[model samples]
Target chain A: MQKIELEISFFGAFRKYERTGPLRLTLAAGAGMAAVKAAIAEALDPAASDLLKVSALADAQQVLSSAHVFDTSAQLVLLPPVSGG
Target chain B: MSQSPDTRSIHVCVRETHLSLEKASAFVDAGENGAALLFVGRVRNHNLNKPVSGVSYDAFAPLAETVMGEICVEAQAQFGPDLRLYIEHFKGYLPIGGISVIIAVGSPHRAPAYEASRYLIEELKKRVPVWKKEHYLSGDSEWLDGTSLVENP
Candidate 1:
């Protein structure tokens, strides 16, 4: 099985719970978004574990649907609700 | 605000540069449209009794743009095809009175222009994937929940 690299990031209040800066994770190419999201939750400091249930996910160009598969390059981000006007 | 030749609407963006009303309005110019309504949002000097010094925003750019575009498209549809839309947001640091967001709508009448502009702004605030950290004059900073529309968990 081939592995795909996804550059992951946390935004807003999630930063305080982040273990480190932007992370690049390699996962099996066939992984589902749920699996990827689980991995992200596992990577965060324990205090941030709850955010996984609500945080939105997106790539560099668009929001990723929940059923997305890991078949392409991923600039993954965990987004909280936005407040821009 | 950017007036990309390919994207005249300039409907979505997240950047570090200051927002420009001129650029936003120009992007949505409808030559024969009777009204071009432009709304500029600025960081307020006070909030919750705290004197705010400035604000810094961060965004999940790709998703932010995508949602912003959708809001613009939806507003156009609601208002009418003749109406054009433009939306832009500035990230990084912006002091009190600094422009944070811009929404411009060009429409055939003042009613639709005003209506669409309000919808675009409210929807933008509710949906765009951008967050702001407020810096207080007391030298303390906190991330005020930007998503007032949703009860944050």
Candidate 2:
């Protein structure tokens, strides 16, 4: 059994937790974004689950599809629904 | 400004300081283009019926800049090739009446200029990776509701 750690950065309403710095998410090796989301849902307060369900996940370059899988540790960003003009 | 060096028709950026409408106006100025439309979005003092003191914007700068450039290209494609566009969104805390965003469009005709300007602002609101937190006069703060980027929950 192998494990991977992801550093998750937060934005928007999620910034409340961002002050603690990037959250370290642990997942099984070969896990995908769905797993990552579930892990985060478990790690944070239940109140944030509603927002998490609607948020988008990204790496350094671009947003990731739910199907995106991880083979190595990575730095990820969480984007809640955006409202900028 | 991050733009194509050769054409220089499009300029898009997310600044940590402040955005200048005058500079945006100058960037889109062209002799052949008869219409230049500039739209500046300012931070107001209230939101959701609550009085606000100021706002702080958080942005994923790299991705925001990329999406903004794509939007400028889309506007040009729909409007006309000769269009010049400028978009700048501010980062950090802004006091009431501060400038939050600016969109400038220069087109060969007034019609396209107006259409493109509207399109840029609307799309920027929905697509950019930026968020705002409103600090209230009551000493509370909250993030405003926004358009969801996820396809399915």
Candidate 3:
């Protein structure tokens, strides 16, 4: 078994956490989006979990689903509900 | 028969700069197109009775632009290929009355122009990867609620 480090960025209401830059998390290799979400929840306070539950994970190109598996370190982001007009 | 919008005829961007209605109108302008509709979204002085000084916009620029392009393409495909569109969303902080977003549509007729303009704005609100934080005069700020993009399991 091995572990990988990921830099997960935040957006929208989550920007308050961004002041510290992206949240760094370590996950087991071959992890998927669900595992990533769980790791994020574990890293932050419980209050953030509600928002995290609804937020979507994305790579540079598109929104990723829970089924998306990661085999290596990645730069990702958390996109909360969008409010742009 | 209508086809997808020509990539050249569609202009979409997400930038941390002022959004210009003039640019939007100019991009969608065409001699053959008789109708040009412009929808500008501005930062107002208040929201939900809270006096607002301004607003700060944050966006995932790459995906926001992509989503906007897709909306414009879809509008043209439904309205007609002759439809030309310009869509932009502003990022960064802005004082009250600053333009936040603009959607311009040029079409051969008013019907399609109106429809396309409405379609673009509505879809942009729902799909774009952008967020708004309102700054209140009371020294408080909050992010407004919005349509979610997350997929439910």
Candidate 4:
């Protein structure tokens, strides 16, 4: 089993949540984004999968669509769309 | 186009109507701006047919500041050397029509300043970790859901 290192940032209410971590999830070589998100949910906050919206980026610039597969190491940012003036 | 913090300028305070035009002007001067555009956000007294008595705001300060800084960096990167930007949001109680946030952008040309200022406010509202609670005269208090009030139990 190959391991992929994922760096995650939790913002807003997620930051105040107890189970948060700068999580690292290992998956098979051709793991998809969905699989990675599931792993993150299980590791960090299982309720995160329901309460928050997740977006993934590779190398900080490229936004990955939900159907996209994770090919290498990447940064995954979770955002819940908090309000500001 | 210097990245050094401007000691003379003051970031606008939360729940205040008056923006420090003086500091904003200084920021423009530091940016060597020929054109400056500022956007002020105000509180509304009503939401979805409900009367609003006032508002209370909450924020994750460290993260909010970092995100605001990132927004400034991105605006600069997109608009280049001719552009400078400032963004401030109010964090406490604000009455109807009170200024809640201010965003100012300066550029050599009018177009970039206007566009960047608008984009900054839009993106900040959508992405920042700030929440607002709305209190009504009828003893009802609810959190604002984006621009609307969400009913709470």
Q: List model 2 lDDT by residue over B19-81, tens digit each.
A: 998899899998998999999899998777999999999999988888888888888888887
DockQ of 3: 0.75
- Stretches of candidate 4 above 4 Å error? A1-80, B1-19, B147-153
Chain B only, TM-score of each candidate: 0.89, 0.94, 0.94, 0.78
**Per-prediction CA RMSD (Å):** 4.0, 2.6, 2.6, 7.6
Per-residue alpha-carbon lDDT of candidate 4 for residues A1-85, written as tens digits (9 for 90 to 100): 7767777765444555535566566677678766776776777656555444333322333334566777677766554446778
Off by over 4 Å in 2: B1-7
Model 3 stretches with alpha carbons more than 4 Å out: B1-5
Q: Write out the backbone clash pairs for model 2.
A: none
- Model 2 scores what on Cα lDDT? 0.88
After superposing all C-alphas onto the true structure, candidate 3 shows an RMSD in angstroms of 2.6
Per lDDT, the best of the predicted structures is: 2
Residue lDDT tens for model 1, B110-148: 999999989988888887888889999899998766552
- After superposition, the stretches of candidate 1 with alpha carbons farther than 4 Å from their true spots are A16-21, A71-73, B1-6, B9-11, B147-153
Per-residue lDDT of model 2, residues A1-85, tens digit only: 6888899998889988776799998788899777889998888889999999999998756778888888888998999999897
lDDT of 3: 0.87
Q: What does the lDDT read for residue B35 in candidate 2?
A: 94
RMSD of 4: 7.6
State how far residue B41 of model 1 sits from its true place (Å).
0.8
